[model samples]
Target: MDEEILVKKLKARDQKVFQDFVNEYKDKLFRLAMGFVHDSFLAEDIVQDVFVKLWQNIDSWELGNAKLSTWLYKVTVNHALNVVRSKKKTSNVVDISQFVRESDDGGIEIQIPDNEKNPHNKLENKELAGILRKAINTLPKKQRIAFVLRQYQNMSSKEIAEVMDLSVSNVDVIIHRAKKNLQKQILKLMK
Candidate 1:
């Protein structure tokens, strides 16, 4: 369905249209949340909450102000960040095993040839992925969000700027710095 039509139906409280919208974007929103929180359950919760908020505010959404997808991304990111903050406040112990498990399923895995079945190669690839995930998590909040939106979400700088409410140049700079920081952290981890 066209976005305008979808929005119109949503604004009219069409349950079927809202269900379709949720089905279409739920996975994308979940992955975006996972990129921040690194916990599947938490990410799922965040996505659900975002959708609920979206439904509640659908009537107020200004159609031409921003794309619906952009608005969704912005809300997901903000909600995920808040969850992360609250989690930090409630728990000081970092869960190493959770990070290791997340490295495999958080959509940040390094691609390896399926033809290469060597156990050693697989283990090394997993280690590299864990290192990369850790490095990404260490970045400043803005940089990490910008990098995830650009890299994992495949969003352009302009799109990221719209979602983040930043200048396009500023989004570019954040992604650039994020790459540099990730490289440095990965090298340090490999050593």
Candidate 2:
């Protein structure tokens, strides 16, 4: 179903529409949440909470010049940030390495060059990917969100801006800074 139509139906409290909406966006939302929180269970809970909030506010949803997906992304980002803040407040430290495992089943796969026939290349790419992930983790929340949404999620700058509630130019600036920071971090790691 079209997003507008689905949203309208969603507002009407159509159970089938709700089911289809969840079926369609559940994984994407989960992946996006995981990208931020890096905890599978927490990501799932965050997405569930987002949908519940959406359901509760369906009637008041103003898709004004924004796509439903964009609104959903905004919601996901807000909730993910809240979870991160809550964790920090609770003095619980999260290990980045724990979320760096192989994404073979395709939940949060890092975009690394894969050469099955060449062990050397694969190893090199895997090492680079690890360094890249570390660098990404070191970025500020906004920069990290911009970089990951652009590079990992393949969202355009405009979409990222909408999802992040920033201007398009601001999104570009954030992405550029993120790249510069990542490059510096990777070079430092190489040293």
Candidate 3:
């Protein structure tokens, strides 16, 4: 269905349309939430909550102001950030290595080349992935969000700027810094 028609149905409280909408966006939203919280259960809950909120507030959504997805992304990011902040209050230190071992990759899968399928190479790839995950988790909040939206979500900088409420140039800078920081962190971890 077209976005305009979907929005109309949603605003009219069409349950079927809402269900379809949830089905379509649930995984994307979950992955986005996971990128921030790094917990599958929490990410699931966050996605559910976001959908519920959207259902309740559908009429308040200004259709012409922004795309529905941009609104959804903004809400998910804010809610996930809130959860992270509250989690931080209860624990002063987070063990990045522990999370790397236990956490999901926010729906991202590491792909090994066919020619590099040796067991030893596979092990090295997994280790490198873990290092990368840890480095990403350590990034500053804005940088991490920007990087995830750009890299994992494959959103354009303009889309990210809308979701993050930043200028396109600002989003670009954040992503750039995130890459630089991740490189430094990865090198440090390798040592």
**Every model's TM-score:** 0.73, 0.68, 0.71
lDDT of 1 by residue, 1-191 (tens): 98999999999999998998999999999888877776678889999999999999988998787899988998898898788667642122222332232355565443444536655655554454456566777799899999888776888998889888999999989999999998887666654
Q: Give candidate 2's TM-score.
A: 0.68
Q: Could you tell which candidate, 2 or 3, scores higher by lDDT?
A: 3
Candidate 2 C-alpha lDDT tens digits along 1-191: 77678878988899988988888889988888776666678889999998999899889876565787888888887888778667632111222342244666876643443477655664555455455545666788889889878875789998898788899999999999999997887666644
Better of 1 and 3 by TM-score: 1
Candidate 3 structure quality by residue, lDDT tens digits, 85-163: 7764212223234223322756634344354556465544445555555667779989989988877688999888988
| Cα shift from native, residue 142, model 1 (Å) | 2.0
Alpha-carbon error at 81 in model 3, in Å?
0.9
